[model samples]
Target chain A: AQSVTQPDIHITVSEGASLELRCNYSYGATPYLFWYVQSPGQGLQLLLKYFSGDTLVQGIKGFEAEFKRSQSSFNLRKPSVHWSDAAEYFCAVGARLEGSQGNLIFGKGTKLSVKP
Target chain B: SQTIHQWPATLVQPVGSPLSLECTVEGTSNPNLYWYRQAAGRGLQLLFYSVGIGQISSEVPQNLSASRPQDRQFILSSKKLLLSDSGFYLCAWSSRVHEQYFGPGTRLTVT
Candidate 1:
């Protein structure tokens, strides 16, 4: 079965510092990957997605992700972190079945804490 | 632009009570709809999905059920709420391209 793994359970970084969240996926073929962020008591927001194109994909909220097929990883990065950026991040892989797109499988998520 | 909406932002029900959570989408047609559950400290688990009106596929066997009465309306229901059913339920929509858009989600607590 296809699965997504987020190695870090929690990360603490200073405001204005760089941030990177690691994600690895196990899939049979070229996988469609995505990053989503969720604030406390809020819904998940799409950060970035990679279907097919340049390895690097940019998304809302100044976030970007690089899809490394060799590593089977799609890591999310931000040049500078903000207090508002503190939230839980999830990595997901889209499942396709019988020539149609299916649901998604998500990682457990990583919680980020921004220190001032 | 497409938008998804879920009602009853938060719900508290006793065990054995019935449940009905509604989700709807606007500005799109023939879009795929889904229902997911997020347990505390866990990832989102897909509960059900619908490809079109009256087409429902369940991913897991649980006390919950889903229905799509219209093209963009999805409903999650349960005859008897169980303590284990308490979780954050999310509704999402996706186009043929497979990029999902999520709603604000509904928090259900069964006591």
Candidate 2:
């Protein structure tokens, strides 16, 4: 049923403070959002995507995201927090339902802690 | 400029051993291959995908199985191994939409 919801599984900021990580989606029509980052053994890294127009999307290290389609939401931002930007952040959803072969439906990540 | 390669980066077996994990993709062509699993820290679970050469598509069902004889090779098999099938095994590739390109993962430990 196309789902993605990352409601902060763990977050703690304080190194210049400023970060917002929350993503929500249910998909039915226009949706192909993504944001990934993993740095422990590394494997995922593609921090920005929102296919359509402009709703604020900029990624790669400094990170930035915003695609609010009537609040279906796609939020991930970073203003300052940096302790090497503690990793583990994912939010993905790409639906091709009937045509298939286009997979990506993930969410269950968000573990950031930067305090120093 | 595309690249994806997964191997035995780290593997430890013991229970009914019999498994293979190998994925390769270099620059692109009929590309769309995937096999993901991350059960230690969790997230990314899409067992298999292949859109050519032999056509295989499965999204999690059990003791692994995947193959794409050519076009950039992709193989993940298991004839007996299962200890809940270890964890952290990723290999990905894409050519459009939502972007996907990953590989530098393979940490299977079963016992």
Candidate 3:
């Protein structure tokens, strides 16, 4: 079974500090990866995705992710954190499966707390 | 432009009450529709998905059911919701490319 794991349950950082949220996936093949953000009472928003080609993929809201096949990891990063960036982050992996188009397995989210 | 919509942004219902949540999409055809549930501060759990009308697949056995009677419309229903059913419900649509686009969620609270 393909699965996604986010080791950190919660993380706190200052508004001007750098940010990095870790994601590790267990998949047999080269998997499609994505980063999504969810705020309180809101839907999950796509941050970035990696299908093929470039290892580093940039997305909306000044977010970027790097796909490391050797590490089986795709980590989300930001040069400087903003207060608005405080939200729950989820890393997901998509793979083809029988009886379904494709399933997106998500990691246990990491809640980001940003301070002034 | 393509857009997905989920209704009843927030709802509070008794434990034995019925449930009906709706989702619709615009500007696409033969799109894949999905239902997902998120517990408080938790990741998304795939509930059900439909590749086309009348074709539903369940990821987990739960107190929920889904229906896609139209190409771009999906519904989630329950005979009686439990307190455990309180969470955020999201609907998503996608093309064959497999990149899903989500709608503003519905916060369901079953008392």
Best by lDDT: 1
lDDT for every model?
0.93, 0.86, 0.91
Where's the lowest-lDDT run of ten residues in candidate 2 chain A?
Answer: A95-104
Candidate 3 fraction of reference contacts recovered? 0.53
After best superposition, candidate 3 residue A59: deviation in angstroms?
1.0
Worst 10 residues of 2 chain B by lDDT: B93-102
Best candidate per TM-score, number? 1
Q: Give the TM-score comparing model 2 with the true structure, all chains together.
A: 0.35
Candidates 1 and 2, the one with greater DockQ: 1
lDDT of 1 at A74: 97
RMSD of 1: 1.0
- What is candidate 3's DockQ? 0.68
Which stretches of model 1 miss by more than 4 angstroms?
A: A96-98
Question: Candidate 1 on B11-88: residue-level lDDT in tens?
Answer: 999999999999999999999999999998888999999999999999999989999999999999999999999999
DockQ of each: 0.75, 0.24, 0.68
- Model 2 clashing-pair count: 0
TM-score of each: 0.98, 0.35, 0.96
Over A1-116, each residue of candidate 1 has an lDDT whose tens digit, in order, gives: 88899999999999999999999999998778999999988889999899898999999999999999999999999999999999999999986556574678899999999999
Candidate numbers sorted by DockQ from highest down:
1, 3, 2
The TM-score of candidate 3 is: 0.96
